[model samples]
Target: MTRTLVDPHSVPAELRPYLQELVHRTHSVCGPHLVSVIAVGSVALGDYRHGRSDTDVTVVVDGALPGRALPGLATALAHPALPCPAAGLELVVYDEDFAARPSGAAGYLLDLNSGPSLPGKVSLDPAQSSAFWYVIDRSVAHQAGRVLYGSPAREVIAEPARADVLAALRASVREHSTGAGHLADNRVLNGCRSVQFCRTGRWQAKRRAAQAVAASEERFRPLVNAALRSYERPSRTAAAALPTADVRAFLAWVAERVDETAV
Candidate 1:
């Protein structure tokens, strides 16, 4: 069940062929019920950290497939190189209704912001938008990384949401000042930690080692700052939470931050 992690480049070189084969194989068995198979996660984003990453894939099947046939596909994904044994493979079958409003579409939260897909491409959905936003708000603000898939693979996800993303990004930078035990505990901090950890094992380890420096005082300060910062002036970059009044308020708050920083 344990497979060695493939670097982003190697993943596509190795996994893509297998995935294409899997798609064809699924088509043969399930008939024309299969739609597309997409790859998500670090591999999709291109900013994959070599060793500490796993391939996240989405198998888009046609609605015609019977419920019973799915377990078989799950069983099929488990190989030495692509070890999606049992629970590892998350098979999501989309009906025509769901397909149109894919929550994991190219512009969805994380995927919109990720790098390039190593092997295959995945779609996104908008209903699950909140979760994606939550992850980005916490992760990007705190970490350093890139997207590998969806959108224009070469175009960075950072551009669309730069101002707000930077706001969170700046917050994460400040989070590192305090001793936050693990990056995941803080969204953006975790993203930053993941990027650092992926690149040089020792570098993140070194960064983690310094976590004890500011400890409680630093941690409390950042959290308080984020709360106060986001309170009066919440971000408008959140597509779900934007309106004319909210946008105006958010912009005013952003201006205040710039003014204060300039002073």
Candidate 2:
């Protein structure tokens, strides 16, 4: 079954006009080559917080956009005249072939992150890399994505393999836990969600995932609560309130559990 488009009214008032403009501009730039533009992540999930959240979009094109199109799209998106309304906009461009066919590979034509602060920034050089995360993203888009243009998301995006999804989650947890400093709120909350998904094959938002972890595991309650607070009201003080050592210990424990389950 196809998912319904996100109710425009549900979008943040400040962000709605900008999002509409973005879709219009994207269509103008891509022309007929553009397959669809999908709104994903928090905005699509109805959990967006004006200043804290980001506007995530997936642009599916017919094929690799010509080299010249890149700069134009970047310039258009980052024009000082049209200011971004959130922390930033994270947009990933993928080819229809890639979306229709799930390859356990990593590569994207354009991965653009731009906003008023960082105008016209593009990360396309490393076109080839392990894109395990894209698999999970595709799954998200297929299930919950909001289509701004073109057909239903399921028509253009394929379901990711369960193993690939697990691999991506494992990689994310490892990356987050490798450092020694206090973990970011997203890192802590996402780590919990990843563990939960690995164990139960159910995906949930970060806060809900933290609640689930707290409900099931008494040992993780304190750290999870700290993360939840940080997620709710993101601030350096809230983040610093977390017990760094305990957070690391919890992450390590989660890593071990994920590893055990994988085995």
Candidate 3:
């Protein structure tokens, strides 16, 4: 049986107009170079919350955009004139050639995270560069991503190798596990999702993954519950409520399990 895909309109009503405008502005900026614009992550999974989730987008271009075009696109996306409703906009721009055959190395043309904190500011961080993010995003996009422009996501994105996905998850967990705030939440939840993927060969949103893990392993229930609670009601106090030591132990345990199954 053919599976039904999540509708792009499943994104929160308050955020839909902003996403539409983002696509229109991107099309205008990239012009003929534009290949596709896709929405991935929670939004694509139909698990997005208006104030907590981010609008994760991947813009595919025909070729590497000119240096001048990079700043122009950034300015256009984070311009004070175009406001976003969610926590922020996490967007990455990729070249079609590279996306079609990713090298498993850091080579994304542009990585942007913009929000209301700095309405007119668009900070570009090379430190945020990771082939893992691209690879994982590609896999998610292929499976459940919503196409906002150009071709269907499956037509434009290649399926990431299982080994590659595991590697990316490992790297992600390691990198984000060091912090106590939002990173802690990300590490715990994403680690659970990674463990779920390793066991089931299926990707799930963090909340669902946490629920699955809790259901399967009684010992992990408390940690998963904490993460889910924090995810649902994100705040400084909620983040602080998480048991840091338990989160660390969970990460280590999940990482070991993932490594044991690595091909």
Highest lDDT against the true fold, candidate: 3
Q: Over the stretch 135-181, how does candidate 1's per-residue lDDT look in tens digits? A: 23223212322222221211221222333433433343444334243
Q: Top model by TM-score, which number?
A: 3
Ordered list by TM-score, greatest first: 3, 2, 1
Candidate 2 Cα outliers beyond 4 Å, as residue runs: 1-7, 79-81, 116-121, 126-130, 179-183, 234-241
Of 1 and 2, which scores higher on lDDT? 2
Better of 2 and 3 by lDDT: 3
Error of 3 at 222 (Å): 1.0
The estimated TM-scores of all candidates read 0.37, 0.86, 0.88
Cα lDDT computed for each candidate against the true fold: 0.35, 0.72, 0.75
Winner of 1 and 2 under TM-score? 2
Error of 1 at 248 (Å): 30
RMSD of 3: 4.2
- Sorted on lDDT, highest at the top, how do the candidates line up? 3, 2, 1
Residues 1-263 of candidate 3: C-alpha lDDT, one tens digit per residue: 11122244656677777887888788778887888888998887777866677778988888756656877898888735568777778888877887786345545677877875322334344445667877888888888888878788888887787888888888877766776334466677888888988898877888888889999889889878877777777533345356778887888888888898795
